[model samples]
Target: MADSTGTQARDTRLYFPHLQTLDETVRFHAERQPQTAAVRCEGRSLSYAQLHQESNRIAHALRAAGLKPGARVAYLGKESEHYYEILFGCAKSETVLVPINWRLTAPEVSHILQDSGSELLFLEESFAPVLEQLGSAAPRTVVRLGATEAEPDSFPAWKATQPDTDPAVRVTPDTPLAQLYTSGTTGLPKGVVLAHRSCFAIRDALAGENLDWIDWREGDVALIGIPGFHVGGLWWATQNFNAGVTVVSMPAFAAGEAVRLIRELGITTACVVPAMLRLLLGEPGVTPEDFTTLRKIVYGGSPISESLLEESLAMFGCEFAQIYGLTETGNTAVCLPPADHVPGGPRMKAAGHPYPGIGAKVIDDKGQELPIGEVGEVCLRTPARMVEYWGLPDKTAETLVDGWIHTGDAGYIDADGYVFISDRIKDAIIVAGENVYPAEIENVLERHPGVAEAVIVGRPDERWGETVHAFVVAAPGDRPSPRDLHRFLAQRIASFKLPAKYEFIDHVPRNPSGKILRRELRDRFWGDSERKVN
Candidate 1:
């Protein structure tokens, strides 16, 4: 594909030809390093050989349970070795894995399950209440993740009866492997359908480049600080697994636990958000000595504050690279290499240059490509881009136009190709790496009995990058307390999506045509800030 500059991007497949499909990763690595630990989580570990065998069993069990090729298998749980087993099993069975964010409310989870048309669901016992709340929306075949010996519907018990032989299912690089749901602008979540090839495209492009930026090495033990439900975490884990490195999974991210894991396991590389970095730095008794083994720390999700970046650089004393992209772009297509990470370098604030085979351009509203340093909507063309937004042809066409993923981010590329993000065009708030769309929250807020109209905007936050703030207009003679509104929103949405602050307004500002002036409202909170996003 040619970039906006009319230059053709190199084909990634030609650079590295191995591991064309997700299933091929484990099989190839198992043959080469069968005894090496593929993943470790909560005192449990799985070797390459063991993971391959377990996934095979899961594949056979899925088939025996009447799941057909191309079926959607939903997983509602935290990060774990069993989660990856289900992931690869879905790959081997030609079924798509839909990993639900465990943080989502029952209503939100139900929407994904029903929308994906999943026939089976693998859930953690802790989320039993959520599944029960799903009721009719829940899939018919539900299997518990860690079940006892007496439980016949447990994942371990169910797969144990199946043979641990490869299902030998036919799959192509374009086959849909995972469906991750991202918050939509229309008060719902849209499933982003990613294919097997998405996992290998970026890695293939960088294979023999010998670039130290985000490179993998022998005996490298990586910390999966992010959860598997997010594309960043999933992509990072798969990249390490493909390179035959051991990945230590954190079932849930905790600053104290992460520090312990890094020091105890001699973790060499990690990928995390800036919020996590702050938490680690603030953790009690944390010091520079605890991160001696860390060679590189890759961070993204939101741009890092200069002060925070400098502090993290000093604490870790390791190579730091910033990644920029979305789930639609298969995690990361642009990388700010360590070379440009100077404390106050000119490019320090920039997002970064696109990967070898990836193309990025900023375009005006008229669809014309903007010149260097001209602020506009950023677009990316990469082999790692999602196949489509699942079952939404109209949205797919709108987002994936002419082979370029229209990233709803307002940014520009400098003469040196360093992308600088200035604002978000879609009015989406990212709280601690989690995307929270205003429309989704506003829809819920306005549902409250006292709220006549509501608007949600992001306020720059020191730790979370951004926090949800609500501007609510109450009904006539109805006085709504912040506490009451918080309680109402808490039960309906994820905790992260709840508004951190609420202000009662007489009226919500709107344009002549009735469109809410979101930017006008947001500008009040971001006054004089260099960038609109924190």
Candidate 2:
């Protein structure tokens, strides 16, 4: 480990010489600690040796199946040991992995599959209907997971026949590893192309900074509750695995099951969004004892209420930290250290300071830097920054200016260097930690025959951080109730994206430019809530 002083560690690459690519790190650990447990999911465990061999097999199989380097392989399923195997296999063969959220509707799933140009798709049998609906839109090759298939085309049969020898493909740190799709401000989701360097750049910097809380130790056990599709889950699991630690992953976020797994696995550290913590607290059998083994808990991606934070602190009795970043930035660029997590510290509400080697600035509309304490767009420049939005040069150019990523979040830096997120400049609704765009839902709602027009906004909810609320303009001589619209949209979008409440208005609020006045609708619902975001 590096000393608290950052200089020596930075020069030495934090004693990790294999920082050239993720594949290098995996090989490094496989050689040194082959028998050590690398990952665990459900009742199965994979040692470092097993992980390396499985990934190698998968890579060879992918090559045999005619998947060339730089080809995109997508996965549509929940978290599992197979996730890491395929992810590392992609890195080994220089293929990009695209993990789609299983909650998406068929059209949404199809859009991502087609947009990413996925050559091969790995998914659970439960989601086979989604592909059946796609027909021509589906990927060329589909591998079914979960159950054993005896046919020659089955995932198990194919991987079992492949060679266990490493592919030994040449790749640089800049090689693309994954394409994570964040909901687009427009209707379609935009793929954020993340390179192999993203997994290590920030982590290596932190290692040099001697930030022990964020660092993984020899016997550390990490619990990943977040889905693998998002940067949070994949990044967290990779960080721990890179450190040669064990990662216990849950299939999906179920409050009761999460608590049980944490207790059963003796998870020392965890990464979760605030909503998960709140939900975990509500589970019937969850008690303080269940979290006794946890040493640290990192929460972010949405605003955490002080009341809930305090409740969690009292119940868990563990170190708490906050991470702030986006899918485009790999993961955390700004992190609130555990020291500033005091009960009523001024910095508690802040997003914390930027990590070492990370540059953050608040800029005005003209791209001019704003003064400290003045709200503006939060911009970040870091080595861990994404390569681009996959295949969207214009959108990539729009977000990445020079070397900085324009975070489209309204925030300001304090004199103490903490970033305070005030509002979102983009029209996005974060419902229970899931990014929901109004345009996407509006597009679905407007397609209904009885809906002449629609505008979607977020409203505060006690259970979910925020819930989608819709204001609809019914078609002449035909009116649709909220229940009717809900049923209509049931097959079109994720259930979570469905509006929690609806207001039938004659005319939807629009500016002279004919754009929906989302702020006006948001203000009507938010009222005097100090935090514009729920």
Candidate 3:
């Protein structure tokens, strides 16, 4: 097997030699750590060996159903033990696996299934109604896990009655192994295609590295609550699982349940958003006394304020690593190391330095490279990059060029190599010739006692062309008036940066991954028949 072309026709060897499919990645680890507990779901724990056998059973079931190689199968369900089986089973059969966020609306799921051409749908027993709305797309191959079947025409149950041989399957380096839909903030969801080589390259890339430098340990068990639909959740777990570490899964994140998991599992390494981290820390019994075993908390998604960060540092008494990357660029484009967690850090809104083998830089609107300390679009070149957008070749060519993924995020590197994310390229509000990054304004607003969470979007104004309006979620028992909220933020930032209008709400609409739905906020204002809201 040669890893080159323009030579004699031999076995095709991929760039990453370690793994070619999810099945291989899981099996290699399972064989090595057969006795290690791989999953703990609702009162059930499956060892690596048990997970292997169960996944094999799922593979056998798929084969029996006449699902061939390269078929797209989506797991439209929440995270659990069965989710892993469906993912690995499809991988073993050389099928593309798509995990949909259970929190999404029916239309969102329908779009994903139709866009991905998913032939099989593996759903949680509870989510059967979700699929019920999207009628016979892909023949409606429903996968019910451990529940009574729905009536006529519903799909088959994922039973483990039969045994399946761990068959040797082939996956080319370029073969698409999975499809994940993006946030669809700009428009419709883009199917981000990831190949076997790309996926394994990342897993293999970090395998030999010593996370010990970051205080990671084999003895550490992580409490993971991020939805598996997102790349962060799925791949972060993959990294730990392969490292022979245990991960306690939360089907869906709840502050109370996560606190319980941390207490019960002695969780040490957890990858969570700041919101979840805050929620966990704010809970009744989350003192340093309660978290005796916790060691490292890695967070990203969005920025955390200095106050929250410091409070969390004191509360957890562990290393906090902030990772920055997008679904398009794979993982760890930039990592804010624990050393940056100083008393007065400059990596304030920064995402941090690029990971090994990942090249990053800031570029101006004209596509020319910018000097350090200049705010521009952040871009990266990495082996872990996505091959292409599933069906948008034009958009693919625009975003990915000369092997660099032009991260739509607007930020720049400092003189010291730290990357600060200012705002989204499309999200930066241009008001009366002044550029206002929502993140900066939102950051200040979120620190206010009354503001629980904040999102900033530009609304059209006849005079300024656009003005900043805030959609804020107030803290419990606090509802400051729009005027008061504006006054609260006026001293923190410039007058123009102050949100002109405020809409108080119970909770800000956010994605399952905890990213504020800024697009939705914009749509609320932009979708109305009238324009230029005063």
Candidate 2 lDDT tens digits, 347-457: 878887899889999999999999989999999998999999988899999999999999989989998788999888997889888999999999989999999999988
Could you tell me how far off, in angstroms, the CA of residue 265 lies in candidate 1 after the best superposition? 0.5
- Candidate with more favorable, higher lDDT: 1 or 2: 1
Instruction: Write the residue-wise lDDT of candidate 3 on 1-534 in tens digits.
Output: 323321112422112345555677678767777888887877678788877877787777777777888778888777887777777777777787888867665655787899888877776778776667777564457666546544432333345455756866776767776788774334366888877665555544443352332333546687776777777787677656545567688887888887777777788888887667667767885678767777788876555556678888888888888887777786556788788887576664567777656788899999999998888889988777888888889888988999999887877788877788765655756554344667777777888888888888987654454689888898888887888887777655557567778877677788999877777878776675222122
Ten residues in sequence with the least summed lDDT for candidate 3: 5-14
Give the lowest summed-lDDT range of ten residues in model 2. 5-14
Q: Is candidate 1 or candidate 3 better by TM-score?
A: 1
Model 2 misplacement above 4 A: 1-17
lDDT scores in order: 0.89, 0.86, 0.71
Instruction: List the candidates' TM-scores in order.
Output: 0.96, 0.96, 0.76
lDDT of candidate 1 over 1-534, digit per residue (tens): 434322223432112245688788888778877999999898788999999999999999999999999899999999999999999999999999999999999999999999999999999999998988988998989999878857898877888789988888789889999999999889899999999888888877776464556777767899988888899998998888777789999989999999989999899999999999999999998899999999899898877888999999999999999999999999999999999999988988888998887899999999999999899999999998999898899999999999999989999999988889999889889999999999999898888889999999999999899999999999888978999999999999999999999998888888999988888899998998878988
lDDT of 2 at 520: 90
Error of model 3, residue 101, in angstroms: 1.2
Residue 200 displacement (Å), model 1: 0.8
